[model samples]
Target chain A: MNLVDKQLVKNKMGMRLIRNKLIKQLFLMATLFAIIILGTLLYRIFTQGIGYLDWEFFLSFASRFPEEAGIKAAIIGSLWLMAITAPISLILGVGTAIFLEEYASKNKWTRFIQMNISNLAGVPSIVFGLLGLTVFVRLLEMGRSIIAGGLTMSLLILPIIVVASQEAIRSVPNDQYEASFAMGATKWQTIRRVVLPAAIPGILTGGILALSRAIGETAPLLMIGALTFIAYLPENIWSGFTVMPIQIFNWTSRPQEEFHYVAAAGIIVLLVMLLIMNSIAVFIRNKFSKRY
Target chain B: MLTVERNRPMASSISPIKDNSIYTVRNFNLWYGADHALNDICMDIPTNKVTAIIGPSGCGKSTYIKALNRMVELVPSVKMTGSIDYNGQNIFNPKFKVEELRTSVGMVFQKPNPFPKSIYENVVYGPKIHGIKKKQILDEVVEKSLKGAALWDEVKDRLHENAFGLSGGQQQRLCIARCLAIEPDVILMDEPTSALDPISTLKVEELVQSLKKEYSIVIVTHNMQQAARISDNTAFFLNGEVIEYNKTDQIFSNPTDKRTEDYITGRFG
Candidate 1:
């Protein structure tokens, strides 16, 4: 090879190797950055919260003193809220999904509705709180009760559940529907027996995700005036309630160092609850997937 | 068993009732939106016989068979004219319920699509929907239908297992068994063996032949040899029209139409 050609080849090889190394290192650094930040946060939370995460922390009611405070009332309130939110959101969300996916005609109106739902999912959760404040709290006279808070949370997560459910329902194979129809099944019969069963795993997955969001949501519930200092469990749907995230938010806002530890402890509890819900969702999905 | 006799004269001259014609289609035409899918066609499908519709891809054979059971209407903007008479009743008539008509005219698709359910549930799905609730009756129906599809011996022990556990051929046979559970008067097969291996295709072809003894079967197949092997009568469709339809022997051996001859000889699609 000529001297110029040899030098040119050398330069090309060197550049290629250097570029590859640079790109790989850049990606690795990006991933490590995320892991380091997350690791630090987790380490801090565990260290600060471990001492406060005992049975007393769970059994005692919320109090002015950080050492005496517990999440007993908040835990019950969160459970009550979920008991209302889960069924309402699941039924309404799945119903909307079925109507849109199976019944609604694919036309301008459906596209318009679909576009609006996607947009609703992106809108700030606090906006839903305002809407719920007006509709449920003032107009409906629900008045900051657990029912009002649950309804607000449902509205907040409704779009996510609907979109998730629609995706799930749409993923069911067209062949299954055709097979069911070929067997003398009506539209309703096919949907009930084949389409819904096949889509249930996806629906449950979406529902669990939405419920997790509902559990962690404090802004909407706070906007709806859920009390942060309730000492007793809710007596009925009409009774006011406070959830874990709100209680933690209340603790972290206090002008005391010890309350921050209590906040970290409350965060750990919320995380565990979310983990349990997610595990149930995964179990259900796997069981149903194996069946088909 | 029906004899596989070749060179038998066409039964066109006999009255449909005497000849046991289960379906008498006349001047049937179909359009999906502006595109014509099936042209004006007239044919007679005899009861207790296998009639195969042979065509290349998109030649409208599947559309014609779907029209027989009123399934063609499921597509959006589908328009049909003329009549398909099933047992002397026009299936498209306003008084005829599509669901009731479908109950007597079961269909199997190109893909073996068993519901994501247990084998027992898949088989008993049809009868159960029509209100056969007793477990004893459902068990009997499941066994008889599986036997009818030649799948009972293989699947009897695993009836409660998920239907997806079966192999491709077994799944197809399971679908056939599911169809049989309803005890329909006719079974429509839409290229039912196209998705299977050679051995599985042979198994399905044999099952189709055996099923003809009990139910009138209308099959659409791209495989010409499959049509010849399983059908008593064959219809050659090209470009949304039936060029010639006759006894299977004549259609394959001495097709009157030049187009049918060219197609059968594989000169062109």
Candidate 2:
């Protein structure tokens, strides 16, 4: 038979073929859209911000105006924030996740709490700002203080931290629990020694992702009353504080073009910090997943 | 063709473990959600004997064994109306803690589920939970249980290694050692070697035969040959009912129930 004449060709659409084409087209579209958006963002950031970087930018402290400024106070503010937010959020978020996963019996109340958490995750960051302002700042009367800002940020992202932590803890296989029980270990012992170690990497990844989000948040801080400009370093919880985002906002809002360049410098520093946080999260995830 | 194979004490004319003594079950019924899982199970387990429950799939043999220590309570939808007597007391009594009861009657699953921990930690995990914090005592218990399971020599050199690193046979032996360390009254095994190769199956079978010297054992297995080889007493369950109970030799050679004989001879499942 000849190659062209002896073969059959399909002219009708099969359901499977239509579905396959849809899936392939969808995947290609998503990938291309993601790459394009990411490229644009990186290009805009690097072009405006890259040339503004210098040795003095890293060394000198912030000024009331961008005419005499660096990110020293802002960087220190971020470092201090990490010191407070990381441990406090970790304890509360991981504890709540474990409680929901392990000890909460099947009931409507537990379901209600779970629904509230997911809804809180969906709630806008600025809404949390209003919440923190009303509850933590004005209601508590801890006004314009660094601790108030940090604690307010903690409240803002607490749902994300808890939700991600719950997912991490739940990913552990049920066999591990059964194995520990069969070996006559108590419930607390099993959780403390076996389940926690197995879930550590996942928990750390969730935590770092959440903390990165907290680092980028300025709307909540603004609502909770953060000082945009500060000359002196904060030594106590009640001292006035200014973070990198507030510093960037202060510089960018000025009438001078030089101030616009300084805002670019602050954005660059923030990008590098967020990058390091993401890298640490990926590293921890890989390390523990291998052991498990 | 069957020979009586039981350890008889010379001074005792009757087996004290029998004659309405030891763990007694009376008119037990269990349900999983709306499905009746076990029905009307009436039997007594001896103090120091291996009781093998053999049956087809969905026959409630596994359900009956879990009823011994109320391990069935863990399943959220499980409900039971039965009195399981352990040492002349109803195991379902209000004061009995489920944790304590489970500790006293340890269980091994069908698959070898070793902890993601060192071999030494797997053995010592039990004692540590029971408030035995003295390092010296925990050391003794780990060594003794590992030696009893016949795994000490092979795993002794690398006691600190993760248990998942071991072979399947070694891991199953490690699980048995884990159960043995708590000093339980009865050890319940649910198809302990169903997930292993023939070699690991044989090793676990041999270990079960020797284990009866210290602990009462109840095993649920689908393999007829394994029941014939390792158990002292045999039970046959079919469709959530006890079809027959007899000595092991009688079960393999001459079962009273036609269903049991048919199952043993491989005529039908």
Candidate 3:
């Protein structure tokens, strides 16, 4: 080959290498940027909140005095809300997914319902809170109880669970169904024995994600008139409740300097709860997820 | 000395087949929306015999076998106008319970489709659904079924392990054992060995041969030699029609039709 041709080839190779390196560096820079922001937030939260994160902070009730404030009521309320939301949403979501995926014939009406559900997932959380206020709180006369709040949160996250569950159910191979049916298994039997077991990991992963979102949600609960300063744990589903986010919101909004530290501590508690739940999700997914 | 029937109505052969037949398909025509998938199919599948249906791809061989178990109904747009008599009952009749019909007619697929569960669970799945709740009975059924499929020795120790952990051949055998556990009178295999290695294919063929003594076996296959090796009766399907159906020896040795001869000789599909 001529020197000019060789030089051109060399230039092209050099350009390609440069381009590859540039793209790799760009992606790496983006990742580093995300990590830096996350690290900064975590560092700030820990440094600001570490002092306030102790037994008294967890055990004491919300009080006018910042030092005397605690998240006992908030923690219990969040757990109660979750205890209601998780089962209701999971049952309704998984049932809807099964009905849509297995029983319902593919038609225009089903497609319309599916499309609306996906749309519902993207709707602002505040809108669901308003909906809860109108329907559960007023129309239904649920009166801003834990049940009302839980039901509202369930509605907000139901779409996400349904979508995730549909994906999980849909991912189950048709061969499994066919094999089961060929063995004279009824539709319910096949779903119970084959489809549900195969889809459990995915279903659980979805449920965890939905519940996590529900736990972090403050807007809907606020709109539904949850108290910012509950001193006692709710006795039942019908009793009033206030979750961690609202308590944190209450603390952060106060003018006192100590309340900011308390808010940061509450944030830490919420993050840990989310971490625990997500870890369980990951465990279930890894433990049970199958190739086919 | 071999009687080869060509384009004959199924009713004429019913008298001879009725005594020994497990499935009598008469004028079985199926349509997937506008496309004719199985056209005027008529065949007598005998009891305790391996009947292999051989055809080119998309020639309705698989469709026909699936029809035997009424699995074709799973397709939404599929329509059929025919009578499939299984044990003196018209399966196409709305009055007939499909689940009951399927209980007597089990199926294995082209690929090894174990239920993403342990081998023990896969085997006991059918019996459990059928209300066989006693643990002792299930254990007995699992052992008997696995042994019957000639897979007990290989999988006996690892019965609790996920079935996907097993080799492809073992998975296929597990599927067979699963079918056997249900104690179905007939087993429809839609190219059961097509996805396996040569060794696995041979193992499945041998199992099919042995399985015939207790269960009526209907298989759809692209592999002609597999049919020759295992099936007692063979049917050559072409363009949604059965071109020839006869004893395996006669069909392979002296196929009456020109198309059947061409197909077996690899002249053209």
Best by DockQ: 3
Q: What's the true lDDT of residue B229 in model 2?
A: 91
What DockQ results do all the predictions give, each relative to the true complex?
0.58, 0.50, 0.83
Docking quality tier of candidate 1? medium
For all predictions in the order shown, the interface RMSD in Å is: 1.6, 2.1, 0.7
TM-score for chain B of all predictions: 0.93, 0.91, 0.93
What digit string (tens of lDDT, one per residue) describes model 3 on residues A1-292?
Answer: 5557877787799889999999999999999999999999999999999999999998999999988999999999999999999999999999999999999999999999999999999999999999999999999999989999999999999999999999999999999899899989999999998899889999999999899999999999999999888788899999999999999999999999999999999999999999999999999999889786
Report the lDDT of model 2 for residue A137. 79
Clashing pairs in 3: none
**Chain A of model 2, TM-score against the native?**
0.89
lDDT of 2 at A142: 78
Q: Which regions in candidate 1 have their CA more than 4 angstroms from the true location?
A: A1-14, A290-292, B1-18
Candidate 3 wrongly placed segments (more than 4 Å): A1-10, B1-19
As a TM-score, model 2 comes out at 0.90
lDDT of 2 by residue, A164-258 (tens): 88887787877778777665566788889778988888888989999998888888888877878777788887777778988898888988887
Query: What lDDT score belongs to each candidate, Candidate 1 first?
Result: 0.90, 0.82, 0.91
> How many residue pairs clash per model?
0, 0, 0
Q: Give lDDT tens digits, candidate 1, residues B1-269.
A: 22322223232322223478999888889999999988887888899989899988899999999998888877889999988899999998899999899899999999999988899999999998898999999999999999999999998899999899999999999999999999999999999998999998988888987888889999999999989998888988888987778888888988866678888999988
